[model samples]
Every structure is written in C-alpha cells, then in structure tokens.
Target: MRTYLDYNATAPLRPEARAAMIAAMDVVGNPSSVHAEGRAALGIVQTARARVAAAVGCQEAEVVFTSGATEAAGVLDGFGDVQVAPTAHDALWAHHRRSEKGASIYAMGVANSETGILSDLPKRDEAGWHAPEGTADFLMLDVTQALGRIPFAFSWSGADLAVCSAHKLGGPKGVGALILRRGLDVEPLSLGGGQEMGRRSGTENVIGIAGFGAAVEAAMRDLAEGQWQRVEKLRNILETSLEARANKTIFVGKAESRLPNTSCFITAGWKGETQVMQMDLAGFAISAGSACSSGKVRESRVLRAMGFDASQAASAVRVSLGPETTEDEVLRFVQAWLGKEEKFRARSAA
Candidate 1:
C-alpha cells in the first residue's frame, strides 16, 4: 500500500470537508445576488467566514476570503515599504521592496514551511515601526503551514494581516483567507462587486469555502483534544530511530521550536531529490523541500539562510506527518531510509 507523508505540501482531504463541499454543490446561487437563491449562497459564505474567524481567534468581519494564501497575500501588493523575513515563503518574498527609509510593513511566515522552524511575531518596537493609532504597524503573516499544526491566534499575533490556505488543514485547496485586524485597510486585490467587504471582489467559491470551514472546525477539535501531540511523538520516534543508525545525518531545527509533525534531515553527499525518488519508489511519499517550487528540487534557501553550506542545504529531505499518520508508517519510513543510507555509505566507501 502507498504511504503518503507530505503534509507540509498538502494534507489529505478530511471526510468532513468532503461532505461539506458536496453539500455546498447543490447551492446554485451567486453570493452577490439579492434574490432568495443568492441570499442562500450568501448565508453559506457568511457561515464559512464565521467558522474561519473562530479558528483564527478573530471576528468574522476581519476575515476576507481569497483564492488561497498566494492571493490572500495580494493585500501586501498595495503597501509601499515592505520587509520580508529571510525565511518567508516565496509569495511573501515576492512583495519585498528595499527602501532607503526604514520599512513600515513586514511580511513573515509564522513557521518555516520547509524546515518547520517557528518564528514568533515581532513586536512593533522590534520591527522598528511604531503602531500608528495602534494599528497597521505590522503587516501580513503567512499562516499556511502553521494554522492547524500549531497554536496560533491572529487576534493575539500582533500582525495586522495573516494569510492561511485551506489545503494545509485538509480543506479544499483553492479557498483561503486573509485575516485583517479591524480599523486596518488596504487596497483591494481584485475590485468588482466587493464580495469580501470590499477587500476581495467577485463571486465566492461556495463549495471550496464550505470545505474550508468544515476542515477548520475539525482542525480546531483536533487541536483542543491534543491530537497533534501524538503526531509529535511519531515525529520524534522517526528521528530517534534514524539518528541511531545514521550517525552522519543532521536533523534541522531539532533543538529549536518547530512544528511538531515536521522533521527535516540531511545526509551529506546524498541529494534530497534522489532520496525522495527512492522513497517514492518504496511506496512512501516525502519532499526534498517546499512543494511550492513547481516540483523542481533544489537546495533549500531556508537552510542556506540558516548558514548551512551548499552540500548540506541541497541534501535536506522533509518528512512531515499528520493526525492520520501511525507508528507503523513512521517506522517503515525509518527502515526504508536506513536501507538507503547504507547503500550510500557503501558506495562512498567503494
């Protein structure tokens, strides 16, 4: 049987989410229409918005639905001075603009997607910008990878805006949200009917939003029940088992605050792409790094930013678990990796 373990890329769709989406398919009305059918669609959108707001610890009005995290970050496009964290995702990175004057807006990911390294939201003073009117000092945050995997609250995060994708939390892939603190405003990314309170315009994706809401509800329940703790234990087990046999392997962010389910490790001289292919052939799916790079496996920029040399950077493979992962799967992956390690060692010796 095939074992899928690439959660950092995208999670398997949750059954609750699937059912919600299927149910939403029957709601045949545009959210913007004023007719009864349209109003029904509008109600569905509002319900999903409230669910997302609940999960994010923000007000429903603060949440603006978007195509996904990439489009959610479009609010950043209207900003003038932007400073991106070194480890931020490419979407956030694309908005970076260096200015002679200090930056007023900063973009960052709450956690590093590739390495699972957690980053605390910087305070206003630390960011070198004062919160004018107690709002808009801090800019956007990418919560795509951290949303379901960690305890994060946009209401307390200090950032004025946060972007989250649905697929990261076992929802439909196309829908996501931008959480905007009240009283803060930005130019509309797409201007038309102003469906998302004049922030995002156009008809809503009812089915995807329904799925996202259902997935967020499930994720919140799992978090409250401490289900991720079990996944954390599995991650540790995989690391411990691998470390025992692969003495030369280096586990990234092992001693730091990271996502509990993620383990990024490097075995020098063995390219991550090769390991991923071999593991895939062995019925286990993993990733060389972020799945966002158009499937091109390259040296991890996050590793290089953290001062890893090119060799080690290029050799990192990430195994991210989920609530559904079991002990058997983790151990099986460890065994397969160990076998691969031995072959690499033998070849190097020969």
Candidate 2:
C-alpha cells in the first residue's frame, strides 16, 4: 500500500542490476592479477566499461571508474580556475574557485535535482565559449541527475569532462564514472597499483561495475521504449490534481524544460519538512529537496537562485516519479496531500 515517489534521491534497483550483481558475486579474482582467474575478472570490468561508455556515448578508454560522483568530482581538482553554477549539486559546487580573468574551467550540472530544471550548456566558440585566448578552457558537466531521466551524450554535450553516478540510473550504489575527452588527462587522485589506466588507481568494484553495466543497458531499453513519456503524463496528472485543489500552490520550474519525472511544488505558510513527514506517515515517500540536503532546515539554493523568496524556497517539496509508478498511486498521493493542504489553510485562516 506504500507509494515510493522520491526517485531523484535514488532509484529502485533494477532487477537486471540485482541479477548481474548476484552473478558477479561468484567471480574470485583481482582485476590486476595476471593469472587466468585474474584475466577473467579483468574481462568483466572491461565489458562493463564498454557498456557504460556506450551508454554515455564516449570511448571506453575515456571512462574512469570511481567510488561515486563525489570522488569523480575530486579528480577535477587543480584542473584550472574553477567556476560553478549556483544551481549545481553540492558536490560540484564545493569545488568552485573564482576565476581571475583568464583561462577558467566551468563546472556545472546538466540538471537540478531539487527543481528538475535542465540547463543548456554554453555554445562552442573559437575562444572556447567564455574563456580567454592562450588558455585551455575546460567545461565539466555533472550528469548525475540527467543520465537516465533524459537523453545525454558525453561527446555531444560540449564538455571536456563529465561525471555520473551508477545508483542514480538504477545501478548499484558506490560505483560511478568520470568521462574525459580523448587525449585529455587529469592528475590521479589515488596512486597505487596503476589501475583504471593509471588515472584512478585502486581495485575496481567488480560486482558493482557488473550491475552498473546491466542497469545502463536496461535503462537505455526503457528510454527507447518511450516509458518516460508515460511517466511525464503521470507527473502532469499529479500536478493538475494538486493545482485544482490548492489555491496558493506554486509549481517550480513549470515554464522551463525539466526532467519528466520530477515535480517540485510550494505552498505558502506550509513548510516542506512538515509536508514530507505527513506524506511519509500517510504511506507516500516524498522529499523536501535533494536527498543530500534532507534533515537540514535550510532553504533550497536552486529555488532561491530562480528568484523565489526564502519562504517559497523553504516550503518546496519534490515528488519525483519512476517508470514503475502507477496512475492509482499518483492519484492517491494527490488526494492525501490535498487533505493536508486543507488543514494548513484552515489553520492559516484561523
């Protein structure tokens, strides 16, 4: 009877990913070992690498596996002067360093997790878009939120480097990748046994990598089947139902291009955390904002960046859907939330 709607935080693990991980559990060899057993393990990692590369539209050699997107972002350190979008995820935003009027690297996310807003990358120019001459301008895109929910290709994304997480796309957690353009190099974050082509040196998470490959294949299949279009319809239905009943509600980023599964709405005088708790108790799982920022009583930076005042930013709740979400579940959630909104309105009027 419980409905799960917080997909932007983490997706339910795909069955293909689970099965692949279970199968990989039996493989007993270090990928760095030179023996037959080791070679077999190496083959698994290589195959997964190729699948991941194909999913992101990059060369296999360009992909370097990491613990997750946070570690992937660390690889970009010391690249150059760093500039970040205010709407970027905290992981990418934490790496920002002000540029001093010269060559600079831009780190921005393709999508905002809280508001589901999509950002257009800067156009390519002879001077590398926004940087000055005699400097190698680099663009780093955080594709963690955009990977499976929307169509993205690393080669066509106009990025010198891109990072994504496996768990965000139905793959196992703790496994992610950094995609670098061919012939571009970054200093190694970990130096050990010269693994990951010496870019990231450590024993690869063989089972997680296997699951990541299977999940990417399955996610692509779902995209090709137009499953997200159906999810978008469900999202619109949810929004319409809520808007019909609530008088003072605002849908964030309604006028912008967004991920089909995401809907972030705000109701004045009602805090997002309280609504999330009420929904959870009523058998629905939702979020006030990014899962990373959950439990913190701070306003959404993305909403504030979009010109929303403090109250609206703090009152926002995000309900993200998935292919498995049903129309009945969406309706039920709408009804439950509407009931709560009524009580809040009554108290405000009182």
Candidate 3:
C-alpha cells in the first residue's frame, strides 16, 4: 500500500468523526428557525462551537464558524490594519495587498519558504515611527499549518483574529472556524437572514461541524497523550535520511520551531518539480510546497521575501507527515532520492 504523508494538505477523515457526521446529516433543519427541528440543529451547532472552542482554548462565544479558513481570514481582514506573514496562506496576503489607499496594511517578512527560517516577531522598541505601538489594527494568524501537529499557544500572542481549518486535522472538509478576541467589530461576510450571531448566515452544515469538533478533540487528546513525540521521531528519520544523501541538500526553516511533521528541503542541481513528479511515480506523495499554489512555475513569494536566491527558492520541495506515516516509507523515499541525485549529478557533469 502507498504511504500517505501529506497531512499539511489535508488528512483522511477519522472513523469516529465519520460516524458522528452521518448521524448529524439525518437531522435536517434551518438553524435560524425557532421550531423543534431548527432548535435541534442549533443544539448541534452550539455543541460543536463549545467543542471547537475547547480544542483551541477559547470561549464558545468566540468561535465563529465559516465556510473555511480562506473566508475566515477574509472576515477578519475586513476589520483593521492587516499585517500578514509573507509565508502565510495566499488568501490573507492577497486580501491585505488589495486594500484600498489609506488602508492600514503592512507585510511582515518571514523566513524563506525554501529555507525554513522563522522570522523574529517585531519588537516594541523597533516598531519605529512608520509602525507605532498597537498599530496592528487587526492581526489575523493563519494557523492552518501550525495547529494540531505542533505546539501553538497563541492565547498570549495578542492576535485579534485566527483561522483554523477542520480538514487540516483529519476533520471533515467544508467546515472551519474564526477565533476572535471578545468584542472585535467584524461585518459578516454573509448578511441577511442572521445566523451565527449575524456573523455567518445560512443553515449550519451540522455533519461537517460535528466532524470538525471530533477531529479537534482527537487531536487535542493525542497532544495531551504525547503522540506528537512519536510523530516527531518519524519526521526526524526523514530529515536525517535526506541529509545523509547529498552534501548540497539544504533544510529550510531550521532556525525557528516548525511543525514536527513538516520538512522542506532542496536537492542539489535538481528541479523541485522534476523531483516531485519522480516521487509521485515512485508511489510517494509529497509537495513542492503550499497546496494553495502547487504546479505553478511562479517563484515562491515566501522564499523571495526570506532572501533565497531565485534558483534555491525554485528547487525546494516539502515533505509533510501524517499520523499513518511509517519509518519504512521514509527510508524508501530517501533511497529514491539517492538514485535521483546520482542521475541528476551525472547529467550535470555531461
């Protein structure tokens, strides 16, 4: 069987989550209505809200369900001066970049996507005249990649808004949540028949929501029980295996903490796309980086912003692990890489 290691993209639905979702699908009603059926659906939504809130260590009232993280980010970006990480999901960057004149906006550079260097958070003393203290009108964190698989304690980060996607943590797709600090003014993306406290309007996707909650709960349970350590070991195996193959190979984001399951690296003299295609043919599923912009020949903005030469940035590929990943699979991947590296070096020599 082919090993699956692209958890950063999306995870397979959990069995318990699947069953909960199936049960939820049977209850059909518009949550906006005051009738019995509607109230039942509303109950599911509230329960999910509490569960998700619990997962993220926030209040139930703070969780605003949305179509997904992209929309969630859009909702938060509507509020104030938007500052986005250069390596953040494109949705957040695009929204901030498109703001009108007089729009409070600033782009913070992160470590290169190809190099995996974490940028230091801006300091108060360094805020300069251009960006005064508390100048961040609204800070929306795209914690999609950092959640579930890593240690992320954002409660003290002072971020006004944050987005999390269910599918990223093995929950059902089509469901996500926006976590806002109490009393932030945000206009609803969908207004009319008010639902979700007038923030999101529509009949709640009960099944998806339930599944999302289950996934969050599962991830939290694993975190408490130390599953993260096991996963980290597997990831290290992959990292060491890759590093052993060639001297020119470079690992990205080595300076700062990163998700335990993710590894971004470049093979000397080999194009990322070529390696990706070859790996796919070898029955391995990896990424050239960011499912949001896979297959595009454009230079990675995250890499350029982090200061990598164009070629190094262009040749990076990311290998992310899932709960199901095995050491054997990682070994096989490294063996394949060694073969590919030899061929690539031979061709360059000619």
Candidate 4:
C-alpha cells in the first residue's frame, strides 16, 4: 500500500466538502441574480462566508473570496513598499519583492510551507509606524499553511490582511479568501459585475464556497476532538526512528514550534530530489521542499535564511502528515527511507 506523507502540498478532500460540492451542483442560479434562484445561490455564499468567518474568528463581512491564495495575495499589490520574510510562500514573497523601497507593509507567512516553522509576528504595539493598530496599512499574513493545522484568528493575528487557500484545509482547490480588518480596503484585482462586496469581483464560486464552508466545519471538529495530537505523535516517531539510524541528518526547525504533522530533514550528501524518487519507488509519497518549487532543482531560500549553506539547503526533504496518517504508515516510510539512506551511505563510502 502506498503511504502519503505530503499533506503540506495539498490535503485530501474531506467527505464533508465533497458532499457539499455535490449538493451545490444542483443549485441553478448565479449569486448576482435578484430572482429567487439567485437569492438561493446568494444564501449559499453568505452561509459559507459566515462559516469561514467562524473558522478564522473574524466577522463574516471581512472575508473576500478569491481564486486561491495566490490571487488573494494579489490584494496586497497596491500597498506601497512591503517587507517579507524569506520563509513566506512564493505568492506573497513575489509581490513583496516587487514593492517599492522603504517598506510600509510587512508581508509574511504564519507557518512556512517547506520547513513548517511557525513565526511569531510582531505585536501591534511593538511594530513600528505601520503597525496594524495604526491607521496606516501594516501586515499581510499568508496563513495558507497554518489554517486548519493550527489555531488561527484574523482578529488576533495582528495583520491588516490575511490570505489562505481552501484546499490547504481539505476544501476544494481553486478557491480561497482574503480576510481584512473592518474599514481597510484593497483595489480589486478582478473587475466585473461587483461580487464579493466589490472587494473581489466576478461571479462567486457557489460550489467551491459551499465546499470550503463544509471543510472548515469538519476541520474544526477534528481539532476540537484532538485528532492532530495523534498525528503529531506519529510524526515524532518517524523522526526519532530515522534519527537513530542517520546520525548525520539535520532536522530543520526541530528546535522551533512547527505544524504538528510536518518534518523537514537534511542529509548533506544526499539530494532531496533523489530521496523523493527513492521514496516514491518504495510506495511512499514525499516532497523536496514546497510543492510549488518541486520541479525546480535549487536550494530552499527558507533554509538559507536560517543560515544553512547552499549544500545543506539543497539536501532537505519535507514529510507532512495528516489526521488520517497512521503509525504503521509512518513506520513503513521510516524503514524504506532508512534502506535508501543506507545504500547512499555505502555508495559514498565506496
């Protein structure tokens, strides 16, 4: 049986989301229409907005649905200069780097997609002139990777704007949201018959929105039940098992607070891509850094920012678990990975 240890890339769709999407397929009116059918469609969107707001601990009016986190991050493009942590997701980092100098906006991720490192965002009062508490625009947090996996709230995140993808939290792909504090606004990226309260324009994705709502509800239930704690234990077991056999391996972010299901480790001599292929052939799914950068062969900028050399950064692989991941699956992956590591060691010695 193949074991899937790459949940960070994208989590499997939840049954609740699937069911919601299926039900939404039967709705036949555009949310913009004023007719009864249209009203029904609009109701679906509003309910989803409420659910998403509840999930992120924000007012429903503050949520603006978008195509995905990438498009959601575009809402920050109109801001003046933006400073970003190297650990941010590519979407946010790309826009941040393009902004003018003397950054007034601090944009970064709450949790790194590759290393799973959690960031301690500066408090509103402690942050300088452009603090979130002030009238000027301040922080933009990319909470895509942290949403369902950890507790988060737009009200308490000390960010003027926050972006996240539904797919990251067991909802359907191609749908996300941008959360803004009341009274703050962004220039619309899409211009159309005004939708998403004119913050994001275009027809609301009724089906996707419904699924997102269902997924958030389901994820919250899992969190409340403490299912992730079990996954965390399994993650520890995998790391401990591998560390006992591979003394030279370096575990990234091991000393820091990270997502419960993620582990990033490096073996200086072995390329991460090679290990990914080896693991795939061994009936396991893994990744060499962010899924967005998997096709490229380069060092991780996140690791480099943490002061690792190019070689060490290039040697990292990430294993992310999900609530469904089992101990047997993790143990099997450990054994297969150890066998491959042993072979690489032998070759290096020879």
* Candidate 1 ranges with C-alpha deviation above 4 Å: 100-103, 126-136
Q: Rank the candidates by lDDT, best first.
A: 1, 2, 4, 3
Q: Quote each prediction's TM-score.
A: 0.95, 0.96, 0.89, 0.95
Candidates by TM-score, descending order = 2, 1, 4, 3
Question: What does candidate 2's lDDT look like per residue over 1-350, in tens digits?
Answer: 79999988889999999999998889899999999888888888999999989888899999999988889998657666777778888888887776565447787889988989999887667877563222338888899888877899998887899898999889998999989888976788689989999888989999999999899888888888999999999999999999988958999888999999999999966999899999999999999963454357568888888888888888999999999999999999999999999999989989
What is the alpha-carbon lDDT of model 4 when measured against the actual structure?
Answer: 0.85
RMSD after Cα superposition, model 4: 2.5
* Alpha-carbon lDDT of model 2: 0.87
Tell me the tens digit of each residue's lDDT in model 1 across 1-350. Answer: 89999999999999999999998899898988999999998888999999999998899999999999998887877776777888889888888775545335778888998999998666566535442223234667898998877888888776688999999989988899999999886788798887788998888899999999999999989998999999999999999999999999999999999998999999988999999999999999999963456688777878888899999998889999999999999999999989999999999999
TM-score of 4: 0.95
| Per-model tally of clashing residue pairs | 0, 0, 5, 0
Off by over 4 Å in 4: 98-103, 126-137
Please, what are the lDDT tens digits per residue for candidate 4 over residues 1-350?
Answer: 88888888889999999999999999999999999999999999999999989988899999999988899888767777766767788888887544444436778889998988898886555545343323233788888888877889888775788888899889999999999888975688788877888888889899999999999889888888988888889989999999999999999888899999999999996988888989999999999963455377577888888888888888899999998898999988998999999999999999
lDDT value for model 3: 0.71
Clashing pairs in 2: none
What RMSD, rounded to one decimal, does every model reach? 2.7, 2.1, 3.2, 2.5
